[model samples]
Target: MDSPTILLTNDDGIDSPGIRALANGLSDVGEVTVVAPADNKSAVGRATSSEARVHEHELGYALEGTPVDCVIAGIEALGPSPDVVVAGVNQGANLGMYVLGRSGTVSAAVEAAYFGVPAIATSLYLPGDRWKTVPKPEEYDEAVRATRYLIERGLDNGLFELADYLNVNAPAPENGRTEMRITRPSSVYDMTANHDGETVTLQDNIWQLMERDSYSEGERTDRQAIVEGVISVSPLAAPHSTEHHDALDDLAAEY
Candidate 1:
């Protein structure tokens, strides 16, 4: 079906190397139009502006808002209705269930899902110390490669028919070639908050475990897959659901 039109964006801002790498790689698979945040809006999950200022840029357009705002603007104002929305090639990993709701990269894809458009979110998983220093643009090769692989392989196979979006993560390219694993967001939760005399400190202890190679999860979990130097591909849905509960049904009858 002729090359699809792709709407590319990121929470790291329009000028980030990650987005550039994505745009470049996806160009081989589709017509890529980038509309991303004007400045870093990382972790601003699904936030949007009712009205946003947009500026023309060499890459396409930049919105003065969050990643979700970029998608809204791209689909509604700045560019053609996209065949798919691709977010990130994010600087850091956005793995695990607890982190999804707070990740601008994942949220961009979620917004697209609600619009009835298939989407993909990509991120790079750096080892603990490597994360302290931002990697060079070339370092995003692994993420860009994995994204292209999915775009070419998944789009025509009814992959989106089964899932709203895909959450993809890759370890550094230096890890060498590794197999991609179809996985789920890890259920591990390690958040803790401490109150001091005049301050409160919140920490995600999962990072500590990840650093020590001690974090554990099922074989088909995103966190475990990435830690093992493999690409993680998680099929995700935007909606929330609950199993049938007789108690709730009875309560509804009373009401």
Candidate 2:
């Protein structure tokens, strides 16, 4: 029997060490093809460029576009559609409902789910104070380990049987032995905007709180789970959350 084909991608560009680690880790399970942005796309979410370009490489294709574009192009124009799509091992963790619409890593997986493909989006959580200035690839071993474990076990074990996609976050290795936990996205949103002279800067303040020893009603959430040295897996779908309204039905009937 042939091994499963996996299409791998990330928001952090094709040359990023995170993707390289993921590719290497997944080598044992299947044939891997990496298609990702040529440059960092990070928080761009599902945005796509009409003038996007693609460059073929020995490992895979690099796109001058958003993470979503890479997945779409890989499925439609690249070689044989993969059995699953795996995005990231991103330098920073993508957690909470607030991040869902702004994370290119998760967006790539969400895009794949729309096509009925099982997908996994993985990221690493680093210490907030040092993350921006001291980011390093060596710190992602635990994240890669979690991602590899998922790919090896998730498919055959029916984890993705009912899930369209999964959003995974692993803590930095300094946190110690990591445990895997099924989790949900947190609802907390802490962001700010400041104007300095002529420019306005947007900052996500939640990271600071996330680095603290305590969290607010976030124990089982992705953010808290990562802080506790655990790999967080959040099963997600493409369906829009809905609510039934009898008032709307009555209004429609009166009309």
Candidate 3:
């Protein structure tokens, strides 16, 4: 059987070390075409561009746009139709339910899922605020290994039959390869907005909570799994979750 054709992209820009490491690792198992942002587009989830410039890259192509734009161009114009889309080996971990929609890495995978393609978003966990500094390419080995393991068997094993895509987070190589665990995105929310006399500063307090060992997410969540030194793979559907509430139902009926 032929190896899968992969659409590889990242928000860390075409020249980022994380994507380069991921591209090299994936080549061992598939034909990898990288269609990534020409500039770092981090935290810009699912944002698109009406038009983007394409550049020839050593691995594939670079786009002067968001990750979603890269996915579209790769599928529609710049490359072959892919059997799978792999985003990241992102420089920082994308964990928690609240954070997923804000991650360009995960957003790329979500865009692929909408295209009816299997996708996986991979990232390396860097504790605290240390994630602001990108890790060395060698530090991505654990994340690369986990993603490869999934892509090697996921399709044949009926993985995508059950889920649209996967969000994978792994500890850095200092912890070596750990066990893999199936997890859900945690519901923990700790965003805060502080208005100084002049400016409003937004902060994500979840990491601070973790540092204090006070986080409330249980063991089966992505955030906690990484805290315990294991790879977390959350099999997720592409659409935003919806739940019917009784109060809303009553209000509608009364109206």
Candidate 4:
């Protein structure tokens, strides 16, 4: 049997240390090809450009497009489709339901899921004060460990049988070998907007709260797990969750 072929990508550009770490980590599992954005497309979600141009390089392809664009181009325009799609080891963590729609790293995995491909999306949670300072590739050991573990066990064991994709976030290395937890996205959102006569700015404080041990629920949630320095793995589906609503149907009859 042949080794699995893995397609790797990220919201950060191809040169990002996060993706590089991920690629190197997965090298032992299979042949890895990385196709990523030419520049940082963080928080762009699944946005794509119909007119975007692509540039080819020795390592992979770079697009003047979003993370979803890279996945589409990788499968449609690039060679031999991969066995699985993996995104990120992103510079910042992507947690909660509120962020799912706005995160390019998660969007890349979602795009793959829509195509019926099992996928993994990874991120590193950095402290707010140090988020501006880039970390070294060696620092990603835990994230890489979790990612490789998923790749090694997820496919062969049918871990993705019930999920369209996965969202994984690792605490900064200081938190030591974080325990793995199966979780659902937390339903919390924090947004602050400020206006000064002429200009307006939107700020999201969710990451700040995510870093604090006091604010998180001690249960096995992504936010809480990362705060405790453990790896968080969340199984996710592509479409919105559905629930039977016979009561709502009866209410509609009155109209």
Q: At residue 242, what lDDT does model 3 achieve? A: 81
Against the true structure, candidate 4 reaches a TM-score of 0.93
Q: Candidate 2: lDDT over CA atoms?
A: 0.84
Tens digit of per-residue lDDT, candidate 1, span 15-97: 88899999988887999999999999998997778888889999999889999988888898888899899998898889999
What C-alpha lDDT, on a 0 to 100 scale, does residue 134 get in candidate 1?
66
Output the number of the lDDT-best candidate.
3
Q: Itemize residue pairs with steric clashes in candidate 2.
A: none
Is candidate 1 or 4 superior in lDDT?
1
Better of 1 and 2 by lDDT: 1
lDDT per prediction?
A: 0.88, 0.84, 0.89, 0.86
lDDT of 1: 0.88
Which portions of model 2 show Cα errors greater than 4 Å?
A: 133-137, 251-255
Worst 10 residues of 1 by lDDT: 207-216
- The list of candidate 4 runs beyond 4 A from truth reads 250-255
Per-candidate TM-score against the hidden true structure: 0.95, 0.92, 0.94, 0.93
Error of 2 at 244 (Å): 2.6
TM-score of 3: 0.94
Candidate 3: which pairs clash? none
- Residue lDDT tens for model 2, 1-255: 147789999998898888988888888878898889998999998898776888987568988999999999889887578888999888878989988989999999999999888899998877765546435667777777877777777778887887889999888778856788898999888889999999999988888886676655567888778778788999988776778899989999999
Clashes of each: 0, 0, 0, 1
Q: Which candidate leads the pack in TM-score?
A: 1
